[model samples]
Target: MTVIHNLGFPRIGKQRELKRAVEAYWAGELPQGALLQTGKELRSRHWALQKAAGLDLIPVGDFAWYDQILEWTCLLGAVPARFEHAATADVDLDTLFRMARGRAPQGKPAAACEMTKWFDTNYHYIVPEIQPNQSFRLARTALLEQIAEAVEAGYNVKPVIPGPLTWLWLAKGEAYTQGATDAAKLDLLPALLPVYQDVLARIQALGIEWVQIDEPILAVDLPAVWRDAFKGVYSSLQQGSLKVLLATYFDGLRDNVSVLNGLPVEGVHIDAVRAPEQIAAVRAQLSAEQVLSVGIINGRNIWRTDLDKVAQLLKPLKAELGDKLWIAPSCSLLHVPVDVEGEEGLDAELFSWLSFATQKLDELQWLRALVDNKVDATVEAALEAQRKALKTRAESPRTHNPTVAEKVGKLTTLQRDRAPFSERIAAQQARLNLPAFPTTTIGSFPQTQDIRKLRRDWRSGALSDTAYEKEIRAEIERVIRFQEDIDLDVLVHGEAERNDMVEYFGELLGGFAFTQNGWVQSYGSRCVKPPIIFGDVLRVMPMTVAWSQYAQSLTTRPVKGMLTGPVTMLQWSFVRDDQSRADTCRQLALALRDEVHDLEAAGVKIIQIDEPAIREGLPLRKADWDAYLQWAVDCFRISTSNIENDTQIHTHMCYSEFNDIIEAIAAMDADVITIETSRSNMELLEAFENFHYPNDIGPGVYDIHSPNIPDQAWMVELMRKAAKRLPAERLWVNPDCGLKTRGWPETTEALKTMVAAAKELRQA
Candidate 1:
């Protein structure tokens, strides 16, 4: 019989109870005991819900207050020294809050480590900083307690964890202190192993058979030495405690399959959703003692899995692994939004085609049942649901836009480029009268609570359309005056019309649907409900031209019209299954192309199309990265091409590694590219230095993630570091991303320092 297993579930509760409880606990409205109790209750409720949904192996240890990575940090006592104050048994909720929020007790400044996008998702993780010679302990036994709770509730649980390799690989630290390898400084594994051993002993004592150690980094192109390190660590831990299920997701292991098979773990999990061909190769390579967890369900997307298609994909693995086969999701449910049932306001037709965490649980249960040859009434019901859902979605009028489809097909790749960067830059500089090392923001001022309230009022129709327009325009005018006062070389509308960079565009576009309660946790208390792409995406009207034109009207300086690039919009949304991502992205490009034309016609001098999600969408394997990049670069070009050379297209990419894709970045060929580098101290500039990139560039001089204002000295040092790698004449000065999350005082001070730093460099 095929065992049904869930790799993980959404920790955000049915009604986002976890989010509320965590926030309340942080704000001191709820006691620590109440917070822990809420978490415990949520876990029990989820387990019971899965049981009711007929899941055979319900996963535990997937629930967390903030993130699973942080939980693992606690489990392994891998807390950096900054958060070590929470190590005491009597540690108050204040200590935990401080670690997560980057706040501290009175008289102590916040020692916040940098936060950035996690992989390609909007979600953020607290990056662990490890010093050389760091020691580890079993800090908190959260996992053990969770397991015990599952047992007490009469359900067996599979514990889930981010593998040590992925955890260490994701962490960041200060500059090297000695000749140690970058991986060795955080070699807390030697210390971390005993803690795992202790946790395993308890799990074994409790008779739990399986624990998933997710080593997604195995799919990456790693150095040979790390492969040996992986073997050593797994060999050391395979002491018959809890049977290890070493899982790898996001991409195929390919040549690294040997390293995966070499480990002493009991089973291996492979992602068939992304790379279906991996099954046969993995089946041929499996040893007799090992089990195979076949990842058949799509976890990262909302599309209903083609059951017959996926069932056929799993047949080879079942034939080889036999009863040892476990069917599960490709990865954690974290990437997808929470339960679809909670989306009361979602379009009914669009909702039919989608599955959230709850529905996914039901899908897995039926997949196992069908595989076991017990295909009876229950299985039939699920299959019916799946069939009906697809039928409704496919036939729905919402999915078809003949006009959009026709226009999109006619669009050529040439639409992405205005002109060659050198020519465009020269024309733009002359036309706009920009200063040397011209400074501009990445577009967006603080999304203050008052703005949020007004937006909510407008959205709910409590405020009239005229009132909303007046309020947002006034805000834009205020922003224009501020930029003019600061003598900024370029300006923006501050994006008060936008609630989110992508969501704002999504709202104006046809063939997309928004949800009232589809909030998925981005990081900490923050959440984003990505629009559902149900059909062909097309822009009915210009999304941002009105605001851009208004800001341009208020300023003599060049106002940069902003839009999320096609690749970014597609990556951030839950896209359609019938259309290839490339097709959807092209459709979006066509729509954005119209907007670019509209903006340029409205006297918008400079345009910034932000493709921050470009690098995030890169295939996890090196072999496949190029193909994805080609289409992604083409999408950006297609979107921005309607503008003239003097329009000066700029693009912003933040929280992603661009070193590997420098050529692709160059291929997009925007007049200027601003990237996030303040935290890395312009080490990212080294990518351009290595490639001798020809375009004008902006490596942000100040970190925008933190509230603490960076002074002129900090900005000056960053500029100095960047200048060493980039020519001063080729550089533009900017902040990392936007000032949306920052207060006005902090934003003003930081920009002032940034401008002063640019002035200092000019003088030198």
Candidate 2:
């Protein structure tokens, strides 16, 4: 019989119970014991769900209180020296959260460890910090406890860990000397392998037969040295009694298959969803005894599996491999929501075309059954229904727009602004009349508990529309008055009427579906429910003009008409897969262009179109980047460039390395751009300096992602460093990103300090 399995499940509960529990613990409402108990309950529920879904091998150690990477950081005894005190049993959660998110507890502050994107995904992981001569020990209590808890519940479990090679490859440190030659951080792999060996030995003693070691870095191009290092590491690891299943995903292994074939592992898992051509090549290299886990369902998208098509693809493989074949998802289900059955009020037709994490598990099970020739009547009905939905989706008029297609085909270079950067800047300055070192926020204000409650009540019909509008307007008025009092140069309306930057606009646009429980984690305790774009995207009416005009009515200062950029809206949402991404992005750009024209007509002088996900959407390999950036940059320019010179355009990007793409960013040609830099201590400013970037720039003065506030003097110092790189007159001062996730008290004080710093620099 073919085995059915899943790589991982969503750790956030069906109703986001984990988010609430984690927030309560941080707020001191819930004790540590309560938090731990909630974790155990979630883990137990998930494991049982997987088993009841008929998974042959249930995965353990994928559940995390914060992030799986941070768990491994602690397990390897690589806790940074600053967090060493909290690594004990009593305050482990404190240490873990501090590493994931910097914290200030009892008037003492700890800067957070660095965080970055997880290999082209929106999920963020804590970057491991290592010294030149890093040593490791087996800190295996957490993994062992979770595995034991699952085993006691009477389920066959396979423990999972980030492979030793990938872990060291992802780690950060200065160069070190090994023997007579100098080597990078990955050279410490020799020291890291013994710890893995010890952990595997202990796991084997627990009666666990197989372990899944994930080496996702193999999907990228590897240096010859690192490829050779994989041999020594796996050779040492496979010496134990445990069987190792080497897993790779997100892309095909390509030429790395040769190195993989030489490894001494019992099984290999490849993502056939992303790179299906790899299937035949990998099967040719595998020995008859090696197990082949084929990923047929997409782990990154929300579409229902075309079961008939998948069966056709897998039938040939099953005939050749028999019981040695394992059916699974292309990657972990962590990228998707928990279930679609819990969502209500969706269009019946559209709902039939969708699937979430739970439904995907069932798809895997049914696919395995079909391959084994065990499909019963119920399974057959499901397969038939799925085929019908796919057929309907392909033919539906809802998925295409003739008018939008014609407009996209007619696009030309004439859509770009006629004026040069210098002329536009002068025109903007003449109209706006701002300060030398102006101060502004990126976009939003804090979405406090009361504001959230009011929105929820209004949505539920408990609050009248008239009353909700009055409340929202009062909040906006309060924000405008506060900015006036602070004497900031530029202002924002606080965005109290919106939910998420992308979802708010998505709800108002055509060709979108909203969900009630489709939450996916962006970072620790931060989850985003991305909207699904199912068809032709068009702007039916103005989305942000009313708010922008109302905000401008209260202040003489330039209040930016904030909007999420087209590329970002497309990148962040679950976009349609049938059409080309460029075509979909063009449709979104045309929709945004209408909104931009509306905002300009409303007398909003400054408009910000945030494209934070542009860097996130870049291809994993450098060779494939040009084509993506060309269309992406074109989409952004198409949305913002047709405005008047005095109507200044600003864009914001956060948490990405801009050095390599500085020229591409320059091509967007917005009047002003703000980016996240305070976390890197203004190191990103070097790119702007090197490029002699012509447009006005805002290197963020404070890190909004952290709770700890910066003093006025510190802000002044950071501003001085920025001034040294570029002319002070060309600089804008702002926080790294939006203030949506921050508390009101901190937001107030931080802006106050930021304004004061701007004044200090002006005097200096």
Clashes of each: 2, 0
List per-prediction Cα lDDT, in the order shown.
0.79, 0.86
> How well is each residue in 277-369 modelled by candidate 1, as lDDT tens digits?
787677666778888888878988887877866776666567766878889888888777667785767657677788887788878877776
* Every model's TM-score: 0.92, 0.96
Which regions of candidate 1 fall more than 4 Å away from where they truly are?
A: 20-34, 81-101, 104-107, 172-192, 205-207, 312-322, 395-398, 412-418
Error of 1 at 544 (Å): 1.1
TM-score, model 1 to reference? 0.92
RMSD of 1: 3.1
Put down candidate 2 lDDT per residue, 1-764, tens digits, no spaces: 79888889999898888999998888888887898899999999999999999999999988887788888987887877776554434336677777777772332456677677788788888777788777777654778889989889998999989998777766764342111112476657778888888888888888898899999988877777777777778888974679998999988888778877667899999999889999998998789999999988999999998887888899998999988899899999999999999688688889989989999998987887788889999888888888888998988898887877777777874466548988888999999999998999998999998999999999999999999999999999999999999898999999999999989999999889899989998888899999999988989889999888998999888899999999899888998889888888988998999999999999998999999999988876677789999999999988986789899999999887788899999999988999988877787898899999999999999988788898999999999999999999999999999999999899999999999999999999
Question: What lDDT does model 2 reach?
Answer: 0.86
